[model samples]
Target: MPEFSRLEPHVVAEILRICETMLDEFDQSYKHSFRLTDVHGFGDFDSAQQLAADYRRKAAGTPESARERMQQFIDALTQLRD
Candidate 1:
């Protein structure tokens, strides 16, 4: 295994923690969208489609951010190996 003299798994853990928060927020939006009121509906359909799109963007960004963090970690490890 490669060595990282100062690297802490906490960096990744923190990233995952933040990602989980994003997912949780997304879940809240997803759940609230099921409401029959003005929030997510114009009676039978979604009126807050723009809100949904925004959350969809948020959802997509979470993993990309996490992936970027993970890649940075990997790059650091690779540099140490080389």
Candidate 2:
């Protein structure tokens, strides 16, 4: 197995933390507006809100999957570092 130290763990942690924080913020925003049944059509805001809600649900339920994907990205970086 490749040594994990090929990648800087702190950098990995920071990137993951930032992604998780952004996703959490997205979840909160979606939860706050998921039930909005009306919008003035100024950007299809209603549909956008619904889409965001769906994405938030998916993201919340599959956070591990997201993290795994991020890990793969980090591994790719490690390859580059090597």
Candidates in order have lDDT scores of: 0.51, 0.54
Instruction: For candidate 1, list the clashing residue pairs, or say none.
Output: none
lDDT of 1 by residue, 1-82 (tens): 7575554798767766766665565555555543422333324345567666555554434545433444455555444434
Candidate 2 lDDT tens digits, 6-28: 64889978877776665666455
Highest-lDDT candidate:
2
Off by over 4 Å in 2: 1-6, 38-82
Number of residue pairs clashing in candidate 2, backbone atoms closer than 3 angstroms, sequence gap of 3 or more or interchain: 0
| Structural similarity to truth (TM-score) of each candidate | 0.35, 0.37
